[model samples]
Target: MAALLGPVITPEGPLTGQLAGDPFHPDTKHAAKALAQVVEALLRAVIGWLYRLALLWVMVDIVSFPHDDRPAALT
Candidate 1:
């Protein structure tokens, strides 16, 4: 498995990169973890948008014709 160590040294302050991993065979666990994290973030954003959409629907009022229409004023 390749682990990223906190910035030790770099031209620009510090940078993160693969620290160490098997030279012959690498592990897929870390890759899977990274993928899951990205997917979770995306899902969170989508859910948030859906929640806002539902709230907006509730906030906006809708009136139907014939049922909610006003009658003519008396002379």
Candidate 2:
């Protein structure tokens, strides 16, 4: 699902470009753009997947065994 959706969503806007205001130096600009593209795509895909599955956040409780606490097993 991410594979398909990532490309579709990321390319909708121009990603192979300079930063919003602070442009990268000429030599590093291309690399920066590529890295930004990858990060954006991955973030979009992950967020989309989590949102679609209705798994934004589920409650979790941590429990410890050996409540007596006689120095843990390793001890």
Each candidate's TM vs. the true structure?
A: 0.47, 0.39
In order, candidate lDDTs are 0.62, 0.59
Q: Pick the candidate with the highest TM-score.
A: 1
* Local accuracy of candidate 2 as per-residue lDDT tens digits, 1-75: 634444322434533333323465453687788899999999999999988666434322223333576667866
lDDT of 1: 0.62
Clash count, one per candidate = 0, 0
Q: Give per-residue lDDT, candidate 2, residue 13.
A: 56
Q: What are the per-residue Cα lDDT tens digits for candidate 1 across 7-57?
A: 556444443344323333233466767789999999999999999998877
Clashing residue pairs, candidate 2?
none
